[model samples]
Target: MVRLNCVLLIDDDEPTNYLNEKLIREAGCADTVVTKESGEEGLEYLVSCAEGNIALPDLIFLDINMPAMNGWEFLEEYRKLDESIQSQVLLIMLSTSLNPDDHKRAEEMQEVAGFIHKPFTTITLEEILEDYFKSNGN
Candidate 1:
C-alpha cells in the first residue's frame, strides 16, 4: 500500500473526529492523522503548513456544518492560498447531510475530489486510497 504522508479531519463533532481518527489509524493508509474542531482551525493548519510551520496533509476530510466557518466558507479562503500548496492537497467534503443540494454543490467545486457521508469506514478509506494513491502510481 502507498501510505499517505498525512490525513486531516475537520469537524466540530468531537466523537466523529475520534472515531474517524481511529478508523484511519486502523486502516494504516496514512502516516499522520490530524483532527481539528472547526473549519477555521483547519484553514489555519493549512496556512501554517503552506508557510512551512508544519507538514501539509495529503488529504482533508472536511465537515460542512461547522459553527464559525462552514466548509463552504473554508473553501472560499482555501481558493486564495498559494497554488503550490493547493496543488498538493486534495479535499473531500464529509457530512451527514442527506440534502441533494449539498452533494450537488460539492460536485460542482473543482477543489473537492469527492463527497462522503459521515462515519468513516475502513472500506471507504480503502476505496479513497485506491483511487487517489494506488491508481495514481503513488
Candidate 2:
C-alpha cells in the first residue's frame, strides 16, 4: 500500500476538523492528520516541522474562512518560505463556499494542488489520490 506521508488540515471549525480527520483515517488515506484552527497556526506548524528536520506533510487541506488568517493568507505566507522547504509540500484548498471567485483564485495559484468541497468522502479522497498520483507519474 502507498502510505500517505502526512495531511495538514487547517480549518477553524472544530467539528469539521474532527469529522474530516476521522474520515481520512478511516479511509486509510494517510497515517496522520494534523490539524490547526487558524492559518497562522498551520504555517507555524509547518515552519516548526522544517526547523526540527521533521518530514513535512505530503498534503495540506486549507480552509478559506477563519478568524485571523484565512486560506489566502496562509498561501501568501507559504510563498515567502524558502523554496526548498516549500517545494516539498502540496496544498489543496477545502471550503464550503460555493463562490466562483474562490474557485478562480485557487485555480490561479500555481502552488495550489487542487480544490476539494467540504465534507470530503472516501470516494472523493480516493479520486483525489488517484488523480494526484497519476498526474505526478507515481
Candidate 3:
C-alpha cells in the first residue's frame, strides 16, 4: 500500500475523531493523522502549514455538520486558497447524515473527491487508499 504523507479528520465529535485516528494509525494508511474539532480550526491548520512552509495533508475527511463553519462553508473558503495548495489535498465528505440532499450537495462540490458514511473502519480506509493511489497512478 502507498502510505499518504498525512490525513486530516475534521469533525466535531471527539469520540469519532479518536476512533478514526486509531483506525488510520492501525491501518498504516498515512504517516501522520491530524484531527481538528471544527472546520474553522481545520482551515486554520491548513493555512498555517502553508505559511510555515510545511507539507499539507494528502487526504481530508470532513464532517458536514459543525458548529460555526460547516463543511460546505469550509469548502467555500478552501476554494479561495492558493491553487498549489488546493490541488494537492483531496477532500472527502465523511458524514453520518442520511440526507440525500447532503450527499447530492457533496457530489456537486468540485473539491469533494468522495463521500462516505461515518464510523470509519480499517477496511474503508484501505479501500480509500487503494482508490486514491490507483487513480493518481502512485
Candidate 4:
C-alpha cells in the first residue's frame, strides 16, 4: 500500500468530512487528512503551507457547492498560484449534483483529475490510488 503524505478535503458538510476522514484513515491511505469547511479556507491552507515551509498535500478533494468560495471559484484562484505549488497537486471535484453541465465543466477543466459523485467510497479511493497515484495494484 502507498500512503499519501497528505490529503486535503474541502467540503461544507461536516458529516461528509467526518465520514471521508474516517474512511481515509481506515483505508491507510494518507499520513494526514486535513478538512476545510470552505474553499477560502482551503486556499488559505495552501498559502500557509507555501509561506510556512510546510508540506503541501499531494491530493485535494473539493466540493462544488461551498458557501464562501465555490469549487469553480477556487480553481480560478488556484490557477494563479505558482506552478511549483500547483504542479505537485492533484485535484478532484466531489459533488452530489447530477447536473450534466457540472460533469461537463469538470471534464473540460484541465486542473480536475476526476469528478466523482458524493459518498466517497473505499473502492473509489483504491481506484484513485491506482489510477492517479500509480500505487501498483493497491
| lDDT (Cα atoms) of all candidates against the true structure | 0.91, 0.87, 0.91, 0.93
Q: Give the alpha carbon lDDT tens digit for every residue of 33-124 in model 3.
A: 99999989999999999999899999999999999899999999999999899898989999999999999999998899999997787787
Write the number of the candidate with greater TM-score, choosing between 2 and 4: 4
Q: TM-scores for all candidates?
A: 0.95, 0.93, 0.95, 0.95
Q: Which ten residues in a row have the lowest lDDT in candidate 1?
A: 129-138
What tens-digit string does per-residue lDDT give for candidate 2 at 46-96? 999999998889888899999878889888999998788768887889999
Better of 2 and 3 by lDDT: 3
Write model 4 residue lDDT over 94-127, tens digit each, in one string.
9999999999999999889999998899999998
Q: Could you tell me how far off, in angstroms, the CA of residue 32 lies in candidate 3 after the best superposition?
A: 0.7
lDDT assessment of candidate 2: 0.87
The clash number for model 3 is: 0
- How big is the positional error of residue 101 in model 2, measured in Å on the Cα after superposition? 0.9
lDDT of 1 by residue, 52-114 (tens): 757799999999999989999999998898888789998999999999999999999999999
Q: What is the Cα-based lDDT of residue 126 in candidate 3? A: 84
Best by lDDT: 4
Q: Which runs of model 3 end up more than 4 angstroms from their true locations?
A: 135-138
